[model samples]
Target chain A: MTARNLLLGLLAVLIAAPAVIGAYPLAVLILVLHYAYLGIAWNVMMGFAGLLSLGHALYVGLGAYVAAALYASFGLPALLGAIPAAIVATLAGLGIGALGFRFRVNGVYFALLTIAFAEFTRILFDHMGWTGGSSGFFLPVEHGQLNPIALRGPPVLFYYVALVMTAGAFVLARSLMRSRLGYAWLAIREDPDSAAASGVDVFRARMAAVAVSSALTSLGGVFYAFYYNNMYPEQIFSMARSIEIILAPIIGGLGTLFGPVLGSFVLTLLGEGTTGLLEHFGWAAPGAKQVIYGLALLVIVMVQPAGLWPWLAKRLRIGRDG
Target chain B: MTVYLDIVASGVLTGLVYGLMALGLSVIFGVVRVVNFAHGELTVAAMYMAWVMAGSLGVDPILTLPLIAAALFAIGYALQRHLVEPFIGRPEHEQFMLLLAVSIIVLNGLLLVFGPDARHVAVDYAYDSFELGPMLLDTVRVYAAAAAMVLALGLYLFFRFTDLGTAIRACADNLLGAQVVGLDVRRLYALTFGLGCALVGASGTLMVLMRDATPILAVQLTLLAFIVVIIGGLGSMAGALVGGVLIGVSEALAGFLLMPSLKSLFSYGLLILVLLLRPEGLMGRRA
Candidate 1:
């Protein structure tokens, strides 16, 4: 195959993979897209801007609860509620970014700070009665499933929505990487002092990263709230969720375009596959899968330092135009 | 008045153990730039080890301290060399990703190995207690506190004067500079991690004496240790002590004054307050 045809053919295969795989695989694809969307947004900070956030779940959980609360109490459509909820989350990230940067808190300290904010938010939600507290709040999937609500459509429609959102985020990050602001952010990431001395507005660029990343992450959360139809502190804001977000990027290859997507696919498949095996042999398997998951991550982190995506791409001789 | 005094005394006792747990965390963070996400699981591992040593061999839990310490030192060494040290010099995000992965694996590993059932040491400490006036304090709790204090003080001295401890601290302050000066940075990293894990083992042995343990406790204790370390200020020995007592007293006061249901609220709320008020913690250098 010629180079151009090979590239196009690969693209076609990616697009057609979910459609050909049937409903069960399509469901997995939806989860992949949702995770990729979040991972891409997270990457915009950790990967591109060099600001680590261990509590990206703060935005996801808060956005979800906000959207859920609006629909439940105000009887508003989630489409309308999603925008404002996202806006709030963006502002929250913006605030956190400002505080962190103002103090020159980079590296692990910044990661811990993000965690502190998210944990505090989780605590607040856990105690609050209005949004259903620890018992949790649910969105009516039945209502939106009918197509009138713009949210509760069929699994196919939701899958398509997630795909589009993930695609949009990928495109956004790609362009942002090429933009002047992107370069400034990269410069700041590499050397904050040198970047500032070179006339880069370090604060503004970092703030932009935080704002955009936060807003996109909230949109992913909106999908989560609508698709699952239920939300809880432990499920939404747990450290596990944060791990899920970062894993896609980390395993995919930090700062690489398709890394998060590939990471999400591999990790989710691992989880789903392990879970299925456990369920199939309940008596024999029990909790063995968890140990496997942990061991796999440790191995990957240590041995495959570049993550799964880049490694796989090199093996397949695909996607890496470089 | 009597009830208030009892509450305060109990809070102090609980705080001592908290202080001990935080000391290990502080030392590790001070030397290594990474947080030991699996530190709590190490504690749980020690708890199980203590249970086995005591239960199978009919050794007293108190007498098994040296065994716990030695076993934990080996485990900590292996964990550092095989599990953690490979990712040590990477960027902060990479280190975090690695440690978190290890944490997940270890927690689940314990699940697969030990099953989900919570186990207790079921020793004399479990039933022993001291009654002073209207207050009742468990003997294990008081013993654990006193033991922890002695051990923590010993560790403090270790850090203050020992050559190896100074090397660990020097590595923490200037990684590249220390390596240039011919310090065996790799060995230093391993020793520091082993020390940290060993300290956590000390914590778990005591915690098991006072209560039961499960695999899930690792994640929970890790979170609490995160809070304690942050409040104590990362890398500051004295900070961990103050932070632990403060958190303990705060929790106790909240437990007594507010509805018993709000205890967690008070703990996390205080965590947020500490982060906001003094991000450096009480004694940590300004970040």
Candidate 2:
């Protein structure tokens, strides 16, 4: 009961945060929320279903390109364009999952397959001229009055959109966790052979996990395109981007409701904080933040394999409801 | 017709060097059963080592191969003993993450040190070419290919005839059986990793002769290595060379026939096809 109230109170605080905080902090908050949303979506496949996808940037790039293309070509706003974008991404995931599961490309090979597909798509898009090719795809910016319908507005507007996404994804993840599919996913994850013996639809369950995860992640991609107003094939679909997506779930505590959110917050803040410190100290280093991320991943995996959220939850005496 | 022959001949040379790179990966996987995701980064690291050594010592980059090989072997052995040994029997994801993390660190560390600039050795024969009938092959590429072949032959012989090589093969055949036979599995794994890194180091030394050494090349090289290894079949040394030649030829043809950018498209397409049609690869045994 206390946790629920605390969550609602925290939600209220976030809703009112833009009024108090500066634009930079609000922007940071927005990035945190976006990553949190992506992490939650990615958690469905990797954390719950035990399918480690190293190429989730494939869906992100797909969603971004699809919606961005529709907007670029037809002037259809991103709000409506998100549907086809998500569908396209989901179909791609389904294709990959179908091929992998059918062929029994288990463990590391499945991860490699995902990478191959993502790299293949990235190269394909690199030469695709219609969507701007290697140059980049850009959306027109409206500087003056607010345009909520078109998703053209200030940082505060994006903050709220990101907030809604993070909260909605949290709710969705929570509900899925309580569902039969989620249980089956856990069964399959723990022991696929035993799960099969127990009458679990292992293949379908894994596919569903991939579908939901990809669809939700695509929505995050939609938000990314509109918010950034630009999409670069190299940056959008790079392995670095995929690593960023997975880091949160892995670091926060896989399969936990609050893990992704917590992990996102920690990662974004730490990354930004390090960059800020570097600036303050007049240390001009480019890949310092990524080095931090790599070090953090190594430390987290080696020291506390369960991740920070579980450890924090235990210390704070929080309920396992998360 | 001559142009096509020239491209094919050049690609075969490049492919031999690529095979040496993939040979290291195959050797490591065959024995240790842990895929080094950082293979390309380590290769780039070796390239940098060769580049720096050649510049400082005012010697040919080729001369630094043995020293770079020894250095990389030491690094690989230590890396395996300390970092990778724990995750030997653990879940695949853990090992993947460990190496992925290492890759990121190595890549970014290179970026920080090298500043994204393409560095190359100003070898005396940088522009020299050799002619074989109608085919014109770059002299450096021909030498690199010859060097790669020699190294590959050395590795094969080491595996076939050496006592330590037999012990390593025994370990790869059955870990439990090797343990039961009182072989030190940890040391052998480290030695195998060291040998693998040395193979790649030699390739990297040769690769710098063909292309510039840049941090950006790490990921592409890693993917290229992966494509070669998969196409050749995992755990098959000879398969690595065959896959390398196939990929090398296709890339050369694609560059001439299609677009240079589309060369990877063909390689990746081949990778997907191989995964779907023959997951075990051209020469890999089906487990």
Candidate 3:
């Protein structure tokens, strides 16, 4: 089957899922799609541009805090608040990218730089009074404020919104992968010095990747805040959170378009399944999900290396390049 | 002022332990060219082991040092030989991701076994402090710092003068060339990794003297070690010590002058500044 057809079929099933599945399963599906959105956003930078940022949570936390604060302080609509959140996250990404790229801090050093920035922002938020500091910020919900258009409604409503966002992100990623910028990002990823020698403008391409990826991630963050109705700096801007964002893309297949989406679904299901099994057996496994993720990554890296999605794609003859 | 001098003194002492924390990471990276993301977890595991020993056998945390070091050396050797050695020639990203996966597995495995609660080992002088003229010093901190200094110096000497250490350095400098010179590169890699873990184990035993052991502490320590190593230069032992002390003093000053929460901010800020302005670090040769 062609990749396009496979994606369309998946979308159809997802759109129809709310009708057949119970609320619990729908919530799980929402979580899966949430990760899919994040994974896709991360793939653009790490997979395509060869920029490994282990601290992408900086953008996510920034978007969440900004939208939540806007709603709480200025009584702005949460949907409208995402615009400013995206802008802020984009600017932050550009600043960080400029700092690292201009100084020639690539590879592992670049990843560490991203983590440091995220840590700095987390500390800043932890002490900021208006954002509620470590106490957390809660959004007020009124009796008549469950507007579907504004993303303030039931799980089903939010589920559809999440689906639309994920689909939109998938389309954006697909188009970007085919554009001139995408080719430039691939060249830079392979060899930046050679790419520059070939007149590809390495720094600009990298900065653009960071900017686009950060903006998309911020949108996911805004969605996360409204869906959860609260924001905690410790929870949102955590190293663990950043790790979780990258695992899907890596496991699905780095540098592939469908890898993040497929990986997110696989990981979320396995994670939820393991937790359910543990709960059913009356065992309290506090870190079972992480254990599963870690093991999967280890096994994949040791065995397949290219990730499950690309391997499966090759076997099934769906696409020549995942 | 006395306050300034006291803070500086405390910083230098704590810096010794931080320096020790970075030593193992530096050595591992120096020999194999692969950063061990699980390096911090090895320390956390050793701390837990020390805690268990102290609680069950009624021994001091310091007394469990030999057991922790021996056990960690074995684990590190086995890990490198079985898991990491195969990927030494792979792409750098694969190596990094593999180590990261190992870190996640070890951290979560620890959480599964020990739960999420923080565990600490109590010693006789945990809270005892002595006045040094105008300043006060915790006896436990002083002892831990002394131990750290000894270990750092020992490692420096080992790398400087020992035959095996010279072989390890040669492997780090040029892998194929080292092989051409008839060095048992694989065995040397495993030994270097084991030695690195032993150093971390020693630091972990000292850590139990001052801080609580929790699963989450692994990632924090890893990042701290990275900051120190980056500031000291990736594979430079002397750089790790100077960078560690500089970070320690800056953290103390930040906590004193600003909010306690901003201590990490100061360290991370300095890290970014160093990476931007001088990526070679204080004692490291320019790349």
Decide which is better by lDDT, 1 or 2. Answer: 2
Per-model tally of clashing residue pairs: 3, 0, 0
lDDT of 1 by residue, B204-283 (tens): 88878866779867865776787788777766676787777777777788889986657766776655555555655434
TM-score list, all predictions: 0.89, 0.97, 0.97
DockQ value of candidate 2: 0.64
lDDT of 1 by residue, A173-257 (tens): 8889889988898898888889999999899999999999999899888888988889998679877688678878887887777
Q: In candidate 1, how many Å is residue A265 off?
A: 1.2
* Native RMSD of candidate 2 (Å): 1.7
Best by DockQ: 3
Which pairs of residues have clashing backbones in candidate 3? none
**Candidate 2 residue spans exceeding 4 A from truth:** A1-6, B280-287
lDDT for each of the candidates?
Answer: 0.78, 0.89, 0.88
lDDT of 2 at B15: 97
- What is the per-residue lDDT of model 2 for residues B18-112, given as tens digits with 9 covering 90 to 100? 99999999888888988899999999999999989888898787888999999999999999999999888887788888888899889988887
What DockQ class does candidate 1 belong to? medium
Task: Quote the positional error of residue A131 for candidate 2 in Å.
Answer: 1.0
Q: How many backbone clashes are present in model 2?
A: 0
Residue A111 in candidate 1, Cα distance off native in Å: 1.2
